[model samples]
Target: MVKFNVTRKETSPIDGQKPGTSGLRKKVKVFKQPNYLQNFVQSTFNALTPEKVKGATLVVSGDGRYYSKDAIQIIIKMAAANGVRRVWVGQHGLLSTPAVSAVIRERVGADGSKATGAFILTASHNPGGPHEDFGIKYNMENGGPAPEGITDKIFENTKTIKEYLVAEDLPDVDISTIGVTSFGGAEGQFDVDVFDSASDYVKLMKSIFDFESIKKLLSSPKFTFCYDALHGVAGAYAKRIFVEELGAPESSLLNCVPKEDFGGGHPDPNLTYAKELVARMGLGKTPSQDEPPEFGAAADGDADRNMVLGKRFFVTPSDSVAIIAANAVESIPYFSSGLKGVARFDIVLLRSMPTSAALDVVAKHLNLKFFEVPTGWKFFGNLMDAGLCSVCGEESFGTGSDHIREKDGIWAVLAWLSILAYKNKENLNGDQLVTVEDIVRKHWETYGRHYYTRYDYENVDAGAAKELMAHLVKLQSSIPDVNKLVKEIHSDVSNVASADEFEYKDPVDGSISKHQGIRYLFEDGSRLVS
Candidate 1:
């Protein structure tokens, strides 16, 4: 039945195919290179056994970036050649990273089929375009990023990849149309299913949150909310959820149109990158009493990252997780049965390197368990899948819970809205509402702030960074010498209480991940100043 030629072109090993915790991300040109994306995709299939690749339903979709459409078609053909049962693509090849995870876990087809894994194409908050970034990553059936075991194998396969299989005769299915296209081949009957991108994800969000309560809050005149998608894929869901489902006005949504190049702006959601949102939130140097929105937020390129802000105030991601967890019991309906016992109910608060220490205080007050992991969301996902972590986040504007394996941007916004609604339920008569800053300040006063700050030493030589780390480690061998050096550097410097390299073991999986980072604790529970 296979008529067209499907050749296996011999290729040598290409460099830099290794994926990090999430996926392989590179510039659009790099991915556009002939056979570069193919080699990686084949290697991913090679990593898994033929049994796994054959007759398996896989998801292939991502943020509507520049190359996503082409990549989806290529992957679909490859899946057919590899004897994959069926392939699922989001409508118009658009699905956020979190949404992909949700689809892998919760999505069900009319034929009662489910996805085994997904190839999520995204570069996260990285800018996109012909010259900017593009990416692809694999997720397992549990709706989480593939662990190191599979990624390591994939990298190994990339190094030795010789050829890849593809169904050359299979015509390109129209991804824009929401329907199924079938092709018969030697492998068997193959199908490419294109479906609505937002319905399954929206249902998941509604199950976790009470839309009516949040809608009432959104309708209150005293409660004004703003969302900016940064021209990313989040725009597709923002309208369906915020405006259509929650009754928010259309004007409140900024940059709610998905753009392949993100309107020539960076898609990362931070103070510097999210310039439009920062300006609109009245966070300029000379703050004015302008009629700014009460609450504002932005999602990164793939909609897996978020930045939360209030009138002139910005909420740190470290504090955001704790605040969400502290309020989820009363605000979010999903936690009603409730989250308790770190092991039993997935109550552990897994934090990464730069997460605030204030979370520890909240965990103690709430009787929640906690773990300190390296700077990667995958580590938290591991604990989450093992039924240990319920809520976790990073300092880099990432937040998610056990509801999904990925950090969800829209979910974070809804959590904040829920908290606001719960705290200001009695203030519907145009009275003063409980503000984001007020809640943050109350949290600070109750738990005591960490006075946390970080510095970036960019463009530093790798050799110099290594030498500095070695010198710091050597200094740790003698606290008195370290303190003496510190005093010599600055007269007002304090003595070091302890210094050591950070190491952690996952309580759920009992896996030890080493060389996390170095922590130099000063006498007053603070770190040494550079």
Candidate 2:
């Protein structure tokens, strides 16, 4: 018989558990310390308040990376001891970041229950294994990351947390199968439900996109497509949506199996890390011989980040969101009501010194309202929650819309596919299909192109990185001198109109965030900065 008595284990507070922009990510060994994961989880529960967590349905899942299975069992036991009514988990503890958000928003239980919050286990694009990175972040009922207030409260709770409650003796529930595991607990009956990870997200994608149109494009011999999941949980959804639902050939999918260590390769979907994808797209150092696929894409470890390619060309993340926004009303069925919904979904945008001004150009041309915010995707979520922006993205391969609270990797891929299909609908079987490069080139010719590039000297001397950041700050006082030097260097370069540190005040929450980054604005809508 399973012992379900709650255990009140006294424990000392642990230090350095604060969450960053994404979540509380640390080395796996750092997370393996006694009472580390428990204290943080309990602190998050406390931050949500005892009433909210008690008798509430919570979702727990991740990318099936190392230690995620064990973490899920531990969290399940803790939830039972804390009087949680029911916990929903993906099969085998596998769920992408966006899928977790989809479950919170749409998944319904056997008795019409909906998830109130979630503990998303992932280190995002970071490498994962027993010796690699792992992380956990809490999401609210709104299907968004816990707002800054909640995260701050959780951090504060962690500092003074005296004890954690857990049903330590509860037998580990089997998560490999889709079924409900029941246990009699002191508070009441507790349940753990393991469900298919891809169903809810696949439903959401189907609702938003026209799968028939995409299938037509995929079946066309002229329009070859490839998708690399980087061995993350995305493979579950990609196989379900891309191959099963959309009728793409299984051979077109690569690395579509989840691995504990991401097949010993960095799972980030960038030109630097997604080597197999780059090679298949004919962009690697040793390029492929066969003609590259007409379209190719890759997703990060958790599948909330994406990199899109056209043969050897790459589509910048910022442009991907803007292109999606521009074509959504026509290509995607969900936006068919002309984006003038209960709340008008207009514009694609981001803030100061954008990596690419292409989205700003689209917003300006469409007469959509634009905004500048601090350097964090959460701020974009805030803006979207207020109905201020419809689509947003970062230069670092993240893109999404107000459709879901989080950046979605698969959604971006679908958007690109929709654009491709729409552009060549009449010519699906023709010898020539409009390609990704053509779509991007056409967008540039019409909207005006802005050269975009980013340089990151990462994993460098920590002290030197700090010194470099400080130097950039110090240069603010000499803006005029910098402009003069720029003028001396090249007449084609624009003069610096202003230089300052970026700060933001959230109109929705009245919260202040400062020093997002330094920007050097030019006289002709150009920017050069750190």
Candidate 3:
């Protein structure tokens, strides 16, 4: 072991250090500024209770984005100086956002210690490079993003931070290898444990899913599949799970190599960004020469968001969640028997407010508890922790369950595969297979379809965006005026029924979150939000 001493360095707060619900995101150049990352890291340490920091095991890793390697080393040294007991890192400093959450909640150290928290470093689905985006967020022990209370405190500390501690003599551990490197520090032994990136998460997934059934489905001659990691960290597990475990053909995987810059392509999983997968799935501008696979899926940079496709057909996130919930009892073994022993109304479903009412219809049909929260995973996280939610999703292609706090991209794919397997269990050897399109059509027929579409405008001038939002909110004050304007714009649209800024009051902690979004509801059940 190498001996090290903690050094307290003087510093000052930097502007724009506030973190959003996902975390602080900025260009790699901005994060590379001297003391910028340190200020935020220290502020986060200061925000936590002393016991949660001292002698606590923490996991630190993320999607293999540019500048992540350097950031990992800095955080390791700081963790040592801060008296953290151990830092668990995935091999090569790579771990999906959801994998980090699983590690926090499931991974046990060599000494039988479990992680208390994690610093998840990734800009989610954003592009990454030296000039592109980089990000950092903290997750708590429950494998969920920190609640607003902690994030608010972290923001407050960032504005007034005066100094930060670092173990300057601590050598950077070789994260490429799976082993533990220990350092003798003033506080005692500080260890950096580099482990395989996928084992713990795979174990968790195996526990929740019937891998044998999925393997049988993958082995079927009638079914063909494709998975694109989009060059994100999801690649780290795709081969291990899809090909090695579930027996998907190696040829079925696309862009499975982890690239720091995502191969110069946007890493979002939507049809707009997942061009390669879209083309292969025969949904792009150019049709595929070869027959498209029966099922295709893509994961975003951090592997928390998923876009699932069926040949040339697309499944909206709203329909995806509803379909999963409607069939979960028989499809996925984890959700068998109404999930966590809850029957009927005790089983919970959730969706973001912007999402269509597909899941609502399913919840009513299944007699399950349901909720519409704001467009943040934290809201879903709170409900999941309270055992009030089993499945939740957002219109932005994010989906997950109580299995993990973070939205799990690969898990969503596996869930789909599980459903496929359950549906075609008897048709595996037969030439006629139950196709994804067939299942989706059947779901729509049973639950009634809710057509949905979304448009996103990026890089708008902040002032103009704020003014537009203000105008929309002001328009909501007068439903009749809004209806008149709507009629003048489009005469066929229904009259406005009501409008308001969405608000949420947490059932568990009784915390209030206001102004989540602006909504305009029509008598025809159509809704618009900004």
Q: Estimate each model's TM-score.
A: 0.94, 0.95, 0.99
lDDT of 2 by residue, 1-530 (tens): 24489999998889998988777998899889999999999999888876668889999999888989989999999999889999999999999998998899898999998999999999999999989999999988867788788899999999999999999889999999999989888778899999998899999998889999999999887888899999998898988999999899999999989999999888999889888888988998995998999999999999999999998999887778777767777888777774665334354356433446777778788777777765556788787777676777777788887777888999999999998999999998787889899988888888877777887675699899889788878877897888778879997898888888877888888998877788888998877667
In terms of TM-score, the best-performing candidate is: 3
Ranking by lDDT: 3, 1, 2
Q: Write the per-residue lDDT of candidate 1 for residues 138-246, one digit (tens) a residue.
A: 9988888887778999999999998998877777889999998877876567788999999999999999998998899999988888899999999989999999999
Which candidate ranks first by lDDT, i.e. highest? 3
TM-score of 3: 0.99
Full-model lDDT for every candidate: 0.86, 0.86, 0.92
On TM-score, the stronger of 1 and 2 is: 2
- Candidate 2 segments whose C-alpha is farther than 4 A from its true place: 1-3, 338-354, 484-492
TM-score of 2: 0.95
lDDT of 1: 0.86
RMSD of each: 2.4, 2.0, 1.1
Positional deviation of residue 183's Cα in model 1 after best superposition, in angstroms: 0.7
Give candidate 2's whole-model lDDT: 0.86
**Sort order, TM-score high to low:** 3, 2, 1
- Measured with C-alpha atoms, the lDDT of residue 46 in candidate 2 is 85
